[model samples]
Target chain A: MEIGAEAIVQNQTPKRAAVTTGADRPGRRPSSGRFRRLNVLVGVLSIPLFIILWELTSRSGIVNMVLFPPPTVVAAAVLEWMRSGQFFWDVAASLYRVTAGFLLGSALGVLLGILTGQFPVVSSLLSPLFQILRPIPPIAFVPIVILWFGLSEAGKLFLVVWGVFFTVWLSTHIGVQKVDRGLIRAALMLGTPRRQMLQEIILLGALPYIVVGLRTAVSISFYTLVAAELAGTFAGVVYRIEIAQQNLQTGQVMGGLAALGLISFIADRLFAALAERTVWWR
Target chain B: MSGYRSTTKLALASSQPSVKTVSEQPAIQVSNLSIVFDTNRGQMIAVDRVSFDVAAGEFVCIVGPSGCGKSTVLNTIAGLEVPFEGEILVEGSPVGHPRPDIGMVFQQPHLFPWKSVRRNIAHGPRMLGKSAKEAGAIADDLIAMIGLKRFADAYPNTLSGGMQQRVAIARALANEPRVLLMDEPFGALDAQTRAVMQDNLLELRDRIKATIVFVTHDIDEAIVLADRVLIMSAGPGRILREIAVNLPRPRSSAILIEPTYLALKRDCLEVIRAEGLRAFNQSDSS
Candidate 1:
């Protein structure tokens, strides 16, 4: 009996090994960590290529160096501005306006968007007004904004708020509207109360869209920020660019434009990073 | 014949107590329930005066054709849909709105993609004002019960379709509801996975003893799981017939091969076949 049991076990071992190998062969699993590292490498490689192209274009004189400065020259300007703390002030001012307006507008937009999405009558009544208003550019509002509120911080801030608000609002509305009906039913059946449904179901369902909207609006914030400071400000990066233009300081003008581009790029990258961390669940 | 007589004796014994107290209510009393949907063509009746009493801890299956309103009845019971006429009473109270006393599992897993398996299971308690710690305990217990303890922290997207639906089942049971409404929960899974799920469901039902109202179009599924099967008509859905399964307790996939189980399955298929053929003929005439 013992010898027979041992023979059976020995036969099964090879059979089990064969079966396991056959199963593994069908679905060839690759390591995900390698794919992620490859993506990061591709992104890092693009930065140097961009700088090399900028230097080549400037050296070739295809476009005036005054109009489009080389990346090295812009790097030098960045260093000079950094040492003098002029870069710090410009960054601080821009960040302050964008952050404040973005927060205020987003909060209101999210609230109203959720309401309109949930309530049919509210959505019907408010959708048309928003649809008409959304198409009107934030920059177009600059003249009227200045006339109404003056060229003070309020005027610029209002434009930024308006810009971020509609984007966030529209995305949020779409998000809530498109939430899976089945999931809602599942939640309801599980005894999720009506008042808590928005936070538990609606907001969570709309999170991915909200993140996308917020990230997109970061670029809009920069747009409104630049336009806001261009006409009225005695300070700000745009104002400094205007000063350089008036003085006919080609390098400084290019430098200021480069600074704006650099700041916009950094802001976009920051938003992307924040979105990745916050919306891992999404 | 002996089994039938025994079932009749059991029914009589149960009803004898009710004779003294006819006014006493069932755990779930669905009476004259009808649901109508307004379409471009006209008013369509989905459920037509479907009345049934689900005694506490009874395992019932609502079986019918694909278009039959078995799911609609479950929805009405769950308080997700308001019946056009009649009413549903749960524990002597009319079900006017959704409450946690009833839990539901859908055909699709419907687990939140973002939450881990554990978090999805815990969502019910979290919503019910339980502390995170308390909810976590319930979640852990349920995850273990579903044999998914290893995958508790894994996201729903990372799991297979069967695993996702298993998580959904665990999530529903996490609240420890009195009545569990399952709308073709195994319908989305492959044949092998579905067999495993059916066995798991029977085991869970035996252990938990929660009143289950399962909806399915598969006759074999109806035979294997249900203590009683309610067959429904299509379109304006209504309970056409009720058949007691009367199979032995503690059923598993092997029960399918039993002679009595096969006979009952054939009986169910004949009824569904008649309804299906009738529907086809009517549609053809139109």
Candidate 2:
């Protein structure tokens, strides 16, 4: 237990350089202490500072309060939307589309990526097609999607999935290809058979890249969700924003945007934490 | 089984009338092997008709200059590289792919980063269909032999370079390979650590029954560990000479300071210097 615990502690120190170095360095000075304190203070005050500037400008006869609503108006509008229970439905609808699309798209992307990456024949057949299709923006498909599926939920899912698939696919393909040949040779010398080679060596080797691709796809999923709901949706955060914008309810529009930003920010942070655990050896 | 094998051989000999080299039954054989590479400047010969044999349980070192294909020859024996011509036979079977009975340790430790020391060592046995408990038992034995008992559960990144290489050697031996191919396993270490590892390997070799074929450019390393040294020349690698080190068994790094050791080193250096001058003169004339 001592050895195991000691090893774990040693392994953790270098890994936590970002958090440890700021506190652990020996050359701490009084002026540097003040500078660090100032940095923390600024970080805490950042949102408030921006909100205060917006409020001052809106009320100081510099801008129309209705058109350029401040933080208080946006907060009040969000509260009202929550009270009406429409916020819950909007959030749920948007979340469902993003989650479902991400999972399906990520699954297909990983499958196809491994196929193309590991097998040259499959790569020769499909990579050129994926390359041609990848650059076309998902939003450009919105008009054609309406023609094909007529504002259905499937069309929305398609848009979100399309947004996510190519990124994960390409990253996975590259990751698989980039798996260290040294590791592969080492494994083969250990009597690993062909099929087991993929499972025991290739998958874990490429996982870091796949996790990175998935993280990028997280933001992409959100981007495409907005396009999907804006094209047409009965209830979604972006759909609510569209309706509020049409009615000149700039406060709700701003509130919806803020909510979207907050969600995306939390999601990114959560995935970053998960990514740390995924490639824990790093 | 021997009777049946001889009968089959007799039948095959009668049917084809093939030429068979009747010689000592060696553990590993590389006869007239050649490896060519397709370069930007057309085809280049990497190893040209190089041949050698290792008797059962013998430790052999192949020493040469950088780019002399010493590592290529070792890889061919490990079935990691295909010879352009000629064949490599290990344990009387034609070498084609990496077999469980063959183990290898590369210059870089190349430990699986995610695995603990024990798991890394256990991987060979586990891949060969040993149960988890059985593999663990085997790994623990090697861990003890390598003197890394305390760090059994340590990930590769936490260990020092020499420690990692010790683990690599242990991992390779978990399958009890008959022939172990080492390509500069200690080359990356500092002088002190390298000396320590060499001593450690000498001690470990006395206990294991594996035949070892080690490749190194270091002349002292070749003499200290190997029962026989195969000196190779560069630019289309060819065996220049063979020197058998008659040093007593159970030797240590301390033996490297002996007068006999110096004489052997001088002999090896003389051969290499002569080969170098020849290559240099050839290049100058060209």
Candidate 3:
């Protein structure tokens, strides 16, 4: 023990001397600092500069003004949307569909995933059926959903849930299967019963992969929402966009696109925050 | 193989009284144990007709090179693996699936990431039908025993490798198993941590009553901790020789520098060297 402490003390002396002398070569320091500040300045200007360029081009008539609306025109359309009551319904309807579909799909996916991943017999029964259906895009089912439910909320929810289910299921299945063998052996020796193994070891071991699956499904849920609303809906962001396009309300179309992008972005950010807390140990 | 160093010469003077009553019964007995695996290439023999008995409260170390099947033997005793040719008895019953009375510490700590140090140690007790309060008390005592009281609430990722292994050991002991099997528990640690863990294990072993069977590839570790060292040869692994280490107790890493310890190490190494040469010649001739 004394020898180990002496060795560490000896290692510290040279490190302390190096830290006291700031720059080993002074010539390269200032240029590197300037480049880093320049990079940040350019990054801050990128979006505003693009907006200004679009305004100039639209006003200058470089392209047809009817088709190429600028940011200012889009903002005005958004303000008009807020003045009416429909925007609230549009946002609420879309948020509700995304939230409801995500929860239902994720619950079913995770439960079945755990069953199939942990049990060979369950995998043999369900994995093939899921595998066959998983490759079919949820958007491709819009026609069938319309025929089955005729633009009801159930049809919309079904599409969004379909988009989410497969991604979550496959990831959870792989995660459960890939859980370290050493962990199971250790748990077995510690007297963990087969029934309790799921709660005790498997779920927590596979949590990181499950969180990743859910994060991906968040974006996928939004995509299926667009398909569902576009197929047919009374009041939704994507439905509004479709209505404005038919009337050639180009500014409103652009505004709806921005709103959809913003909401999906925020949902993704929120899920990312939740994911960090879920796997807190990492 | 040296009769002059018969275990009785040192077992008589040892301060550890358990050494005197070693004949109480075999805590673990393996008679003609063999393990064979079927691979794509054909069948392979892992352990071939090997047998040994671990006396109650005895600390036996199985030393060998990699793939010597020493760990396979230990795993079979713990009921993690099965032997095809021979039967194993732990206390008087035939071996099967993992029983609550036999504990194992693997090479990796394998601490549950979601669990705090205390919860990890308490898991075994809770599974055995202990109440929450009773389990918490057991976990607290072990947290103090392993000297990790401050880390009781900390999760596994926050711990150092040595600290995690200490918790794993504590967790195995929480069940108070009659037999403790360790498969190179300190093999993954660095040299300094390995030495420190070895010393700590020595101290911890004296306080616990579980009969220990530790498997390691390192000869020094085997000599430092074992009452009897079982040297094994690789490729259809078999016990090559048994060296009864009559070394005194209250021993530590300091024994590595002692003249007597050096002589004992020499004897174990010579046996291993001869076994290696025999295997090499056989493989070449075949």
**Candidate with best TM-score:** 3
What is the Å distance of residue A159 in model 1 from its true position? Answer: 1.5
Instruction: Give the poorly placed runs of model 1, Cα more than 4 Å off.
Output: A1-85, B1-25
The pairs that clash in candidate 3 are: none
For model 1 the local lDDT of residue B152 reads 87
Q: Write the per-residue lDDT of candidate 3 for residues B1-286, one digit (tens) a residue.
A: 1122323443443456775475656998889999998989998999998999989988999999999889888888888885367989999898888988999999999998888999999999999999999999999878877788779999999888889999999999999999999999999988888998999888777677788999999999999999999999998999889999888888999999999999999999899999989999999999
Candidate 2 wrong stretches, greater than 4 Å = A1-28, B1-24
The two-chain DockQ for each candidate, comma-separated, is 0.36, 0.36, 0.60
Residue A78 C-alpha lDDT in model 2:
96
Error of 3 at A224 (Å): 0.9
Ranked candidates (TM-score, high to low): 3, 2, 1
lDDT of 1 by residue, B4-80 (tens): 32344444444443212333456789889988899899988888888999887778899887778888888888888
Tens-digit lDDT string for candidate 2 (A189-276): 9998879989888999999999999999999999999999989989999999999999999999999999999999998999999999
Model 3 bad stretches (over 4 Å): A1-25, B1-16
Worst 10 residues of 2 chain A by lDDT: A1-10
